[model samples]
Structure formats: structure tokens, C-alpha cells
Target: MGTYRYRVQTSGFGLFLGIAAEATRLTNPPTMNVPVSNRVWLDASEVNNAFHGNRLALNEREVAWLRVGLDKVSGDIERIETSPYILISVRALEIFEVDYAEEALAPAIAGWATREFTLTPRLCNVSRDSDTGQFTFDWNE
Candidate 1:
């Protein structure tokens, strides 16, 4: 089995904070794992409920990290505008996976982002070189 990684980008820190709080409450006891870097790895089963029916295969192992950052934009007025966004990265381990991130996970996140935060989320496919361990991103698909 191989591991597939994908990323989703969306702008909505305030709304996401509420959503995360609710998710944490709904998860009850909390099945998530948090590292020193403050990255929370969501539980696959709970993710389905939190994301409103984005089904993750139980046979495969799935992990996700949510991070908040700012996007800097320079406008014609010579002012820098900072927008907050959340970056979600998902990793799935399976054999013969078929664009699970593009077809399922991303859509789920996008749906929630749009409905809750009125924000659009962008999905990107990530690939890693076996020998060099370098990562590449494909934003087109």
C-alpha cells in the first residue's frame, strides 16, 4: 500500500475556530492526536461526521492536519492586506486509491467551508519522490 497526500486551502479563521470547537465537542473524549507543533490529527471516523458525510474508508488509515496562516496581498494602493486562512493536509494509506482527496475529502471540506464560512477552498494533489523525498504540488487538478 502507498500513502497519498493532498492539501486544501481556505480563508476563514473565525468560522473555522467555531467549527473546530464543535467538532471537538462532538468527538467527545477526543480521538485526535496533537503534536508539539500544534497540529491536530483528526480521527477518520469522526471526520466523516464533522465534515457532514465525507466517507473515509475504514480499511485504510487516514490522517489530517489543520493549520492557520496569513496570506499577504499587495494592492495598487501600496497597502498590504493580510487574509487569514486554514491549510488542511490529508494523508491516506491504501492500495489502488482513485483520487480520494479530489473526489471526496476536498469536496467535503469545500462544502463545509462554503456553507459555514462563505469561503471557497482550493484543492491540490501532492506527490513525493521515492528517492529524493522531495514533494511536488499539482494545483490544476
Candidate 2:
């Protein structure tokens, strides 16, 4: 199916990086607490049309991270062409990046005072010693 893109802009803090992923539902229901102070959920068709019916320009790493979001919505990989997606907007200082080591299962994004979600893993990093800190996300892992 299509995917969801999250972009938030705050005063004095231009805009955080936008994240998107292929929309997939989970087979098992997992507990998720994504607060929506001001949020919007879009359908897969809408996402497709916006990107010329092609996959979004999300990088492999971003896509991998987004899978965490998808898993948060559901544990099993089904197809949900309906509601129950995630979107949020907070101050610029709210966004945080997490470095992962071994044993880190699903992907997740957590902010101060925000609810948490369990991200399911579908991608793995092979390396991270590059100057750009670019690591290859292996979907086969």
C-alpha cells in the first residue's frame, strides 16, 4: 500500500526531517501511545497520488525507521487501507535521535512527555563507520 509522511515545523526551528514508510498493518495488536496534539492521518491512495503514484523518496534508513511506526500501529504485517495511523507536531526541541546497538528490536521515536510505542524490526544496519555516518539498512535481515 501507500505510506505516511510526518513533517513538523516550529518557530525558530525550521523543520525537522520528514519521515515516511510503506503502509502496512500488524497481525497482532500492540500497545501504542502516540499523542496527537495536532495531527493528521492520510490514506494510502492519497499518499500515492501525492508522489505520482510512486514510492516516496524516503531513504533506506528512513524507511526502516518508518517500519517501526508501521509496526507500532499493528504487530502483524497485514494491509490496513483505513484509519489508525500516526502523526504529531511539537516544539523543535521535542525531536530526538536514538543510536541503536545490538538487541535493539523494533524502531521507535520518543520525545519528552510523549507516549511511547513498540517498533517492530524489519531492517538491520550493516555498518556505521562512514564519515557521513551512513549505514546500509539491510531489509533481508
Candidate 3:
């Protein structure tokens, strides 16, 4: 009924990847029937690479949800050049919309959506003088 949350597709914070899976790709009711968008190909190799040797920051329910999404993504990419990869953050809103009405899932989904996507500062190295407030940047080539 209100704004949907937990929508970021990349790995950062706001919503843990595992939690996002439960809200979007792994909702028990299967709320997505439309074509998915905003998704990037995520292969098993990449998944392993991302979490290799590290404990996935998800609980059992979240892990199960992630598995559902991974399975769907794996199937979707099979016939395309991007086969063997699954999509993340694809149809985030659509998926959320379908399940947002549920009482138990709504709060968690909303919280995850609150996470912001951040970009590394791209400007050249910078420095400032303490006394004069003068600024300098290397901008070296």
C-alpha cells in the first residue's frame, strides 16, 4: 500500500543480499509475473567469489529465499549469452509489491530498502591547509 523498500540490486548494506532475496525473489506467494528488469548477471562463480570462505550474513529463512532467487535466475539466463548467471535486484519493486501486504515480511523489507547505495569518491586526491582553509588537489596524470 505504501512505498516499497529493500530494492537495491548490488552488494553494499541497507539490505543484506540474503534478506533482499527473501523479500523479492523468494517470496512464498510468488508475486512476480512480469518481465524482470534492473538485474545484472550473477554467476555461481561470482557468488562463490563474493562469499568464498566467508559466512553468508543470513539466517536460515534468508538462505532459503536466496536459493529460490538463485534458481530462478539460473533458469532465466540459461538460453542467453549470460547463461549460468542469476540476476540480483531485478524486479525488486515488483517482487516487493506482491509481498508487501504481508505483516511479517513488510518491516524487514522496508528496513532493507532504507540502505543507500554509495559510490567511492572519484575526484583526485585532495588536501586542505589547516590555517588558511586553502584546498589543493594533485590531479596528476
Candidate 4:
């Protein structure tokens, strides 16, 4: 099976942060690997037409509602074999600290992958080298 990676960007004030923070508090955060009931592939043309230049803003409640809708429409989506990890810059946002955001968003991003691709994703820690000013991913697999 082929592995896929998708990057999702969300504002700091959305439900994504709230849900993700709660999930990170768990000893072993929840993972999803549900099988798709109805197989329906996404049409690239349609997706692009719908979201190409539009900015879709959704709150926590709206996100939950959208998940339900996605579950119904994207049942036939492909599954991810490998556990995808998240990479966030340490200095990305001023309001949200990198350490906290890393902990919160890792599982959140993984959950997103699981929901969309029917696979359990992993949270990998990111480190920056002081000398080289480069970032490295430590896949805690």
C-alpha cells in the first residue's frame, strides 16, 4: 500500500486546539482504524473547485458536524499503512507556544489522518539543532 501525507493548517482559536489538548492529556491517546463502509473516491476537480481559493473556517462544533459529513461522503477513501508524524516549527506562532502546540496538535493531526485515510497515525517529536539551525524528526516508533 502507498503512504500518503497531507498538511492541514488551522487557526489557533479553533476547536482543533481544544480537542487536541484534551487528547494529549490521556496516557495513551485514542487511535482510529475504522473500515470504510461506502467506497467513494474524491474527485480532484470537484475538491479543487470547492476549496481552491476559499478559506473554510470552522469552529469546534462545526468541525464535529463536518466530520460526520465527511464520514458519509468519503467512506471509500484509501487507508494509510504507515503512522504519519507531525512537524511544527518551534517559533511558528507567538500566542501558542511550540511545546504546547506540539503536544496538542500531534495527536490531533494524527486523528485527522485516521479519520480521512482510515489509519492510525503516530506523533513524532521535532528537535532543532542549535548549531545548524536545522530541524529533525524523531519518529517515536
- The ten-residue window of minimal lDDT in model 4 covers 40-49
Report the C-alpha lDDT of model 2 over 4-90, residue by residue, as the tens digit.
222333332222332232323333332342321112221222222232344333334443453343334442222322334433212
For all candidates, what are the clash counts?
0, 5, 2, 2
User: Runs in model 4 with CA error above 4 Å?
Assistant: 1-112
Backbone clashes in model 4, listed as residue pairs: 39-76, 40-76
Better of 1 and 3 by lDDT: 3
Please tell me which model should have the higher TM-score, number 1 or number 4: 1
Clashing pairs in 1: none
Give one digit per residue, the lDDT tens place, for model 1 in 3-40.
22233333311011112211121222233433212222
- The global C-alpha lDDT for each of the candidates, from Candidate 1 onward, is 0.29, 0.30, 0.30, 0.30
TM-score of 2: 0.25
Per-residue CA lDDT of model 4 for 54-140, tens digit only, reads: 433433443343243234323223232222221110111112233232333333433443543555445445555558744344546
Candidate 3 whole-model C-alpha lDDT, 0 to 1: 0.30
Candidate 1 regions off by >4 Å?
1-31, 34-41, 46-57, 61-103, 123-141
lDDT of 2: 0.30
Clashes of 3: 2
